[model samples]
Target: MRRRRGFVQFAILHLLKEESMHGYQIMKELEERSNGTYSASAGTVYPALQELMEQQLIELDTSSDKKVYSINENGVKHLQNKHLEGDFWVEWKERMMWRNSEQSIQLRGAVDRWEKEFRKAMKHARGNPESVHELIAFIDDMTESLSKKSTKQGDRS
Candidate 1:
């Protein structure tokens, strides 16, 4: 999952606004929230936290052995002022929902099997022009068939 620039900083601020958390907790929460798509490493997360602290958007508490961070007034103000919450979160939620659907799961499995078979056939058909042409034709036909089915379904809708 490639995120847009500054997305990590925005996500960190958003998470801190909810509650105080340590570095490790922040990493895990991000992973869980993204449906295990975005895994935050210590190297990436810690630096972002440090940058936020420097900007005074968040505050670090050193009362306990482990450092915990929470969003300060400036952080809340920045979030509200920027109004950057809509697109990223909405897209994430929609993707998660779509990926979890039963139809999506079945389609993913079928695609995986098709890829494996395609690779095996390609290996055997290497250096054979006729075999390669047949493979390309098969792909083109399948694509046309699926497109027509999709178009018909859209017309019915």
Candidate 2:
């Protein structure tokens, strides 16, 4: 996915404010928090980390062959000055969700293929009661499951 300018920097420092994290872990955090969006590659994350280090916004500790990064005093001050807290993170996540809509690349591709297959099946199954009943039952079951999930999510909110 295409990230906005300075997006990587903002994400790295934002996460560093919480705890020291290795580069891989930081990438995973971005992926998780962004809901499968903004998965920065090593090439992207390392350079950002290096730049943050050069700017003295973050400190690195090498203990177990991994460079763990933590936000320093300067980073904390920068974070505070920028005021990038809950609202900012929520906005960033929303943007990421828009960019990476449809859940995932795999899901998008699968949905496209599945749709074509279903259309073909419907065309062939015309005037077939058994096939129609089977498809309707499957769709009903899926709809019921999805309805339950939606209700649970609404409860959480």
lDDT of 1 at 156: 100
Model 2 scores worst on lDDT over the 10 consecutive residues at 1-10
Q: For candidate 1, report its TM-score.
A: 0.54
Runs of candidate 1 with Cα error greater than 4 angstroms are 1-5, 85-88, 92-157
Question: In angstroms, how far off is 101's CA in candidate 1?
Answer: 18
Candidate number with greatest lDDT: 1
Worst ten in a row by lDDT for model 1: 1-10
For each candidate, what is the lDDT?
Answer: 0.85, 0.83
> What TM-score does each of the candidates earn?
0.54, 0.57
Model 1 agreement with the true structure over 9-66: per-residue lDDT tens digits:
7788989988999999999998788778667899889989988888999999999999
What is the Cα-based TM-score of model 2?
Answer: 0.57
Report the Cα lDDT for residue 86, model 1.
Answer: 57
Q: 1-157, model 2: which lDDT tens digit per residue?
A: 2444477787788899888999999989988887786776888888889989999999999977988899999988887787654665787789787767766667868878988888888887799999998888978998899899999999998
Off by over 4 Å in 2: 1-5, 101-157
